[model samples]
Target: MARPIWSGTLSFGLLNIPVSLMSGERRTDISFRMLDARDNTPIRYERVNADSGEEVAWKDIVKAFEYDKGSYVVLEPEDIRSAAPESHDAIEVEAFVQASQIDPRYFEKPYVLVPAKKAEKGYVLLREALSATGRIGIARVVIRTREHLCAVMPHGDALLLLMMRYPQELVDIDEYRIPEGKGADYRITAREQAFSEQLIETMSGDWDPTQYQDEFRERLQQVIRRRMKDKGVVRREDEEPELHENAATNVVDFMSLLQQSIARKRRTPAQASATGSDAPQSDGPAKKAAKKVTAKPAPKASTKAAKAAAEKAAGAASKRASRSDSSPAKPARKAVTKKRGKVA
Candidate 1:
């Protein structure tokens, strides 16, 4: 069973909905460890004093604030505990803002807000209200002894609480260099605008997450499985086929390529049907050829005698074709020529 990381009441005005926060997602991936190459042993890290170049005990470490260059004021655990946020079990809603008002970059971790025991009525009410308003709830909540700026928003029939970055945590956007444009008149032709709109229409489609996959992950897992089965890693083929220098320069005509692809697809069924019909007719000639090519006792002969025997065999084949009325006899001469050419 899943456990709730936080349990609190979502409060706004006089409304209070008891909710339990639970982590919604997880990552499963291969992790690597740093190791000593010589002995293949895992390497460990140590906290050290930078100035002294010596290891420091965990107990000796304290949070510090750097007030000046090369100077720091250390604060103890007790000092931080005293300065911690006030403990609050409630999520205090401050305002309702348009969902689009928040920049996605400010969003951080997410948690599912499930209705607490006996709080189903209040939870449904808040979910319906937010859905109707189409606005997200801006709230503050303390989690893990730290106050977090968060947004409570409706997702389907439930609430999704996302931690947001504090204003101070984000760098000012204006600090980065931005491109400047000269004050000049610019115009777009009506034809160009219409063509751009048509191009967008041609590429538009509904978003379907099911059509996408992590192909790299799947391939990596296949490799891992093969390795575990005691198979040595298979190297990829090294041969690179020589490409025609003017292949791209020749430029494939798009319309012709599309027509060719359609034609190939249309021919597939016809090709299959043709093969099915020809199989029976092909069997008779194949059987006759097999019988004629069967192994026979060799006749001893001199070089001249061997040439004479070859001429006799050719004469006999021609005589058999003249006697046979079957259309198969015509192809027999072509097959013999092809076979002799291959052998030579």
Candidate 2:
């Protein structure tokens, strides 16, 4: 099993759950080394003092912050450590918010949280609660020496801790000249909208990340292989390394909260609309078409009801035609008059 990057207690209210943090992303980008053009030798970088122009050792290196031009405030390791959160081994949740409320731009990175042995109850409880409520716990976590703003939310069978950028780190949308609501100023026509919607419907499909590949990396690798073949020496690739999941207290309270969460049904369409969780709301033809393509199947009961109503309407129309054909008055008048005229 892979070792956990950080083992810590996840705190919310009076509950504490022991958890381990692990990386959730894999990077497969090919790397290249800087080389001397003339000799094809790897280039080396040196840390040198600006004043003396002498190389510095790793042991002598210290971090510093430049406050002004040609002015720096030297900080020691201890000083940096002291500035970290008081609790290094805890993820302190401050509040819970609807996950839909978070802007996509603020999400930085994703990490998985695993419950320690025998601590699965609290972990599962939290995950289930978040999943049911469609909310995430906003928390402060100290990973290494830096404190990060993060959100703990449910992802399938696991809890995901997503690092978030601070509000200051995000550029305000108002800074850009975004077109006003629905781009009515653009004078888009209903015909254009219908065509756009049809295009989207034709192109839409379930998201499959594997379909996307790094073409540049693959092409570069092909080139390298070709060069090796030309030289009559091909290098064999090394085998890929094999890939490699808590505890809890407050049983009564946890169970109570969990049961309530489970009992609480998912948000209704009206509620979703009110909360703006049903995003990209529109009444355009394209939006309607998209819904037609993506909407869930109607309930069996609803289908039966519609069929029954159609049959009832047909039966009612047949009864009306029968009544008209056998009317008590004014039905035989034309035949009787024609017979009398023929006799005269």
Candidate 3:
């Protein structure tokens, strides 16, 4: 079992459920270590005094807060501890908001909530109540000496505690350069909308996750594997062909294109049927005539040579079986003779 990083109680109104928080995720990425180019060895860093250019020991270092340029204030551990927020060891729920009301942008790191000793009943009750109500609990928790806004939501049979971003952390959308709601009115027409709907209907199908795959990632891994094996790798440069010489002159004929596409699809089945069958009778009259034009004489094999090879194989197999059968009989006779000798 994995150990929890945090232990705390969830408090809302009169209810309290003791729970522990376990880290839920890990990142696996290729990384590089800082190394010296001359020696090809790892490089180490040291805290040093910038002005004196002397390395400072850990015990000699003190935390400082810079108030103004070239001016600083040193703070002791006790002073920082006094200014810290109260660690209540509890996740206090402030509100029960609709899950859809919350913007997805505010979500952050996730953690698994596990019931501590003697807290199983309360944990299950909270999980079931949240699942039944279809709402998430907005709460505040102090983890690692820092206060964090969090959401406690039911995921399957257990609770998922997720850290949330503060409202101040979100950037205001109004500051960005975005299109005003004017030009869109002239672009969309009733007929164009109907054609788009028809196109969507033709493409609509069931959502099967198994049908979708990361083809680029698979190809990338193949390339990497080939490189590792010291094989020559060929990289293809793919470029999109130019759509049109000029936008104004290139007008689309939607109905004509659709008709041509349907015709091409119909021709495909006919072409497939013509090439698939091996029997001469399966092809139509025109195909049969073409087949006669392309036909070649069958290659001949000597009947005597084939017969000799088949007889040799059969004889070798028969001899092997006969030897195996006689060897087993010899062992049986030896056993019988030993039994008679003992009896006599």
Give the best candidate by TM-score. 2
Candidate 2 ranges beyond 4 A from true positions: 232-344
**Cα lDDT, all candidates:** 0.75, 0.78, 0.75
Q: Give each model a TM-score.
A: 0.61, 0.64, 0.61
Candidate 1 Cα deviation (angstroms), residue 31: 1.8
For model 2, residues 1-344, the per-residue Cα lDDT tens digits are 77888999999999999999999888988888999989989999999999999999999999999999989999999999999878999999999999889899989999999999999999999999988999999999998899999999998999999999999999999999976767356555565555555555655679999999899989889978887779756655788653210022423343343333333333466786676743344224556875676673555655665555555545555676556544432324444454456569
Lowest summed lDDT across 10 adjacent residues in model 1 is found at: 295-304
Q: Kindly list the per-residue Cα lDDT of model 3 for residues 76-138, writing each as its tens digit.
A: 998877766686589999999889999999999999999989999999988898889999999
The local lDDT score (0 to 100) that residue 16 gets in candidate 2 is 99
Scored by lDDT, the top model is: 2
Put down candidate 1 lDDT per residue, 1-344, tens digits, no spaces: 79988898999999888888889677667667999989989999988888998999987877899999979999887887676667568898999999998988889999899997899998988889999999999999888767889999999988999999988898888899965553233243455445445555655579999999878888878777878786776665598775332232325443343443344444455785876654454355766765666622223334445565456557658688557545755555555565576569
Q: Is candidate 2 or candidate 3 better by TM-score?
A: 2
Candidate 1 displacement at residue 203 in angstroms: 2.3
Q: Which ranges in model 1 have alpha carbons more than 4 Å from their true place?
A: 49-55, 168-189, 230-344
